[model samples]
Target: MYPLIYGGDARILEEVLEGTHPGLSSLKCRFCQINSLNPNLVKGKIVLCIGHRGGSEAAWSAFLAGAVGTVIVDGLQLPRDFSRIYPCLHLALVQAMVKELPTTSAQQGTGDNRIAEYNIESGTSMACPHATGAAAYIKSFHPTWSPAAIKSALMTTATPMSARRIRKPNLHMVQAISILVQNLRLVTGDHSVCSKAMNGTVWDLNYPSFALSIPYKESIARTFKRSVTNVGLPVSTYKATVIGAPKGLKINVKPNILSFTSIGQKLSFVLKVEGRIVKDMVSASLVWDDGLYK
Candidate 1:
């Protein structure tokens, strides 16, 4: 089942699964009701009563409401392929727009007029499903992966939002690469690295073969991966090391490796820094593929 729950609350999900509450076939109320005004006045018009970042949630809501499509004109486009991102998101906006938008000349007076009825309105909950859906898609592509591996790919591949005001995908495509490595572990069964290993050490990795700078007093962190193909590998193959981390600040890695190839597939990761530092930035780069392994 494609479960879609909020970031928190696992108990409610369990209850629903146990049949205490209605199963997948249940009522769903969505935010961002659509408004039908002059198309000329509001070119891509969909309305949300709540305030959110870039109105992204509301914009997608309208798509599901019954609009042909949605266009989030702020710094919030998918950081990756701008095309597929809209369809998934537009579902909400289309649903909202369909409900609020009146029948057109072509569909006028026909039995199809039920479009505005509650039966016609379409909706989904605002929860982690968005992330889960992405995760599911990854699993579908690479069925043999561990949970950690899948998570790594998604996080690493997540495109970083640009400074521009329009929404976009996450930029760090490293997530997928890391998940593949995690899968390698499942195959070799050489499991030596501890959970702490994913946390990684402080050193210069130089894996991607690029230059990065971490200013003095500034804490910085980066992730690496070993493999993501072949479904029998473990989820902890990629070893993490941190170097030149500034003082007063700490670097952290979540599920250090990318993807694993066992219970599930697809991978992602998160690198975060906390505390204060004197430097403005720190650099991390990949080790170049030279003749001998350095």
Candidate 2:
């Protein structure tokens, strides 16, 4: 059977199959009864909620109800969103505005006729401000940190978020090249230094999130480069783990063990992924964990 679990990763499925994550079995409930949902039953599980607007309402409500994730069967997956990042994140404000906003004719209606929707709106307004504030906060503490470094701090230190579909079309876009590689040689591995940008793929950009958009049942390999700064205890060691990958996937992190000797020290790692697309969408995450910190 096709894996129908929305926002579910391989690790989550493995746990449920092994009877480890019993709370993950799908739960279908009425939207009107969201408040009545028993958290004890929903906790650690992924809830299925039918949504009419942007799925945030269901996602946010389920998040507050303690669900690990949510599946919103809606008319469309308009505006990509995942509850994993921040339970209340609103990347765009259009969804909330469209809900409560009245049409031109309705605005002039009698007071008794107009429907009133009182909502604690959540969207980009909240998220943008939070990011800006957080970035400013990080800047205040480390005046020497560059904007990119500050950005990395927020990303690498923040709690894990949800995943999205990665465009994995096999078609390669042919672009006009002004400069060619001196030797027409392929650059392999992180150590291979190339002055040209053609040697790298957009997917390998150093970002906190990962997404795979591969055709079904096709094998592929990709690599990403990420660096983390030592902000915690000195002389601490950290290791990387791949969590929530789909079946038949293999992830390797080179120099798996990160040992830091001083604060503000930065170390980089190359994460290689090997796997075939078993489904239309594949999602996973890499975690760097120390005994004292995640």
Candidate 3:
């Protein structure tokens, strides 16, 4: 199951609840206590329980009430150590809502007939399928591509969650498909196949994310080599841009401009890093922006 950590924001959670489950006017006493719940009302349905006591306790009560699944949401900031005992999802105050709730209907159906059914919930669990589906679609076209290559395509092409100001995977199927097609051609060569097959370091993995870690009281310089296979039209050039480099650190990318003459042609570059000693963490990103692609 895909797990998501919600940011701490009480107002956002309340806003989500007001829109989706309007009937749920009160969260203070809703399923906060086991004795407060009516089994008939909760049976066979997934329960959204308040995490006043704790997620574990709340989940147990929901299970006892015959809920198919449980969602624990509390307005307070909590540690990320909540255990996954059942099919349960925890939402932070910031990640208040992800699921699209169904609109309530006033008209009731006749006997032996039913109206449309709507299941509204939100979590990384619900979001994971979109990424998986994108992967599956790519696999269908390039049955010969290895899992690593497919993963690289997805990671390298994903949109950064900068708006949320968080470092995480935000899946975009259209972009993934485009990148997969281009990456397939680039990695199809005999020389590119080996590197594409093996797993590499996070920064050098052709991933969509960038991360740099410098241990406390340590001053060091590091260099990384990254390769790109030309899969687009022959004889195209791409330029690299570095943004948000941490202060007190020197970062450089050699041969920042890449030119490819043929499909499967490989180009390698070195990223040199020299930095002063740091007490806390430092972060930055290097992006390749081709004329047609970002």
Quick one: best lDDT, which candidate?
2
Give me the runs in candidate 3 sitting further than 4 Å from their true place.
1-116, 140-144, 162-210, 276-282
In the range 1-294, model 3's lDDT, one tens digit per residue, is 422221111112455546764544344435334333445555666556655564545545555655555666555454322323344333333342333324431112122122234322334675567778899998998787677768767876775444334423344536754555447766564333323445566567554354556677566687777777776678788898888766777788899999889977989888888877454655666877779765
Q: Candidate 2's residue-wise lDDT over 1-294, tens digit each?
A: 112233322122334434743343333234412332456556777766655444555565555556666665544545334333323223332324323444322122233243344323445564566688899999899887877678878876786644442212222334323334543333221344445557666677666555556778988898878777887798899998888877888989998999999988989998888978777666676778888987
Per-residue CA lDDT of candidate 1, range 226-265, in tens?
A: 3333233443344345555556656666655443445335
Stretches off by above 4 angstroms in model 2 are: 1-119, 164-199
Ordered from best to worst lDDT, the candidate numbers read: 2, 3, 1
- Clashes (N, CA, C under 3 Å) per candidate: 111, 5, 5
- What's the ranking of the predictions by TM-score, best on top? 3, 2, 1
TM-score to native of every candidate shown: 0.25, 0.48, 0.51
Report the number of the highest-TM-score candidate: 3
RMSD of each: 16.0, 17.4, 13.1
Candidate models: Cα lDDT each: 0.39, 0.58, 0.56
Which should have the higher TM-score, number 2 or number 3?
A: 3
Error of 1 at 242 (Å): 12
